[model samples]
Target chain A: SQTIHQWPATLVQPVGSPLSLECTVEGTSNPNLYWYRQAAGRGLQLLFYSVGIGQISSEVPQNLSASRPQDRQFILSSKKLLLSDSGFYLCAWSRGSSYNEQFFGPGTRLTVL
Target chain B: AQSVTQPDIHITVSEGASLELRCNYSYGATPYLFWYVQSPGQGLQLLLKYFSGDTLVQGIKGFEAEFKRSQSSFNLRKPSVHWSDAAEYFCAVALPMEYGNKLVFGAGTILRVKS
Candidate 1:
């Protein structure tokens, strides 16, 4: 069975600080990875998705960026965090087709103060 | 462009009552629809998905959704609601692009079951 893991389950950072959130998937290779932010009532907003190593497609252009350094490892980073950047970040993986069902990680709750 | 709309923002129902959540979508070509449930402050769990063949798709937790092509709607339904069913439900539509398909999500509907 495949499982996804995300770290720093909860994070608190001061404004203008650098941020990094990691996501890794086990038991699957060449899986498509995605980063999403969940707001109060706006639902899940796709931030970035990676098809392979060094390939990242950004859905929303903001203070955040994503990278796929390894086949199953995805990282979401921010050079400088903004107050608006605070939200619950979720990492997901899908096998074969991107349209297939995605499995989500536990998620990272970011609080930028 | 593909978009999804979950009409009801909040729905309350009795624990033993039937539950239905409305979802509408707009897309240029054939749409891939999905339903996901999120417990408070947690990641989404896929309830069901509709790709082809059957118009009705069954998912985990005794949940099902019917896809109406003409109506451009994929509504999720459950025969008997449980207290554990209280959560936020999201409707998503997959928009295919050159690179990959992006899932466009609705605002989401909050389901509250009264026991």
Candidate 2:
């Protein structure tokens, strides 16, 4: 069975600090990866997605960026974090087809103070 | 623009009672619909998806949703509610893009099961 893993289950960062969140999938290769953020009272918003290595698509312009350094490894980073960047970040993986359902990781809770 | 609407922000039901959560979408055509659930501080789990064929789709955790084209709605229902069912439910629509499909999620409805 395939599983998705995310690091730093919880994080507390000061404003203007650098941030990095990592996600990796095991038992699958060349899977589609996605990054999403969920605010306190809002639904999830897609931040970025990658179909392959070195290929990342930004769904919305914001302070975050994503990179696919390996086939199954994806990283979400920011040079300087903002207060608005505090939220629950999720990492998901799906099969190659667009019709496939996405599998999510445990997620990372980032509190920017 | 394509969007998903979950009318109920929060719902409370007694244990073993019937439950229904509403969802509506606005799109040019029939798009892929989905239902997901999220426990507090956890990621969303795929409950069900509607691609084509039957209007009613069965999902995990004894959940089912019916897709009504005329009304542009896909409402989730459960015959009996359980205390463990308390969670946030989200309705999503897949918007096909040039590169890939993007899922637009609703504001979500939080279900509170009272025993």
lDDT (C-alpha) at residue B5 in model 1: 92
* Whole-model Cα lDDT of every candidate shown, in order: 0.91, 0.92
The TM-score of candidate 2 is 0.95
Per-candidate fnat, comma-separated: 0.46, 0.38
lDDT of 2 by residue, B42-76 (tens): 99899999999999999999999999999999999
Each candidate's clash count: 0, 0
The alpha-carbon deviation from the true structure for residue A1 of candidate 1, after best TM-score superposition, in angstroms, is: 1.5
lDDT tens readout by residue for model 2, A28-88: 9889889999988888888999888998999899999999989999999999999999999
Write one digit per residue (lDDT tens) for candidate 1, span B6-106. 99999999999999999999998888899999998788999999999999999999999999999999999999999999999999887654546668889
Q: Could you tell me the lDDT of residue A40 within candidate 1?
A: 60
Q: Which candidate is the best by lDDT?
A: 2
Please tell me what DockQ candidate 2 reaches. Answer: 0.58
Residue A85 CA error for candidate 1 (Å)? 1.0
Interface RMSD for every prediction, one decimal?
1.8, 1.7
Error of 1 at A15 (Å): 1.2
Docking verdict class for candidate 2: medium
Question: TM-score of the second chain in each model?
Answer: 0.97, 0.97
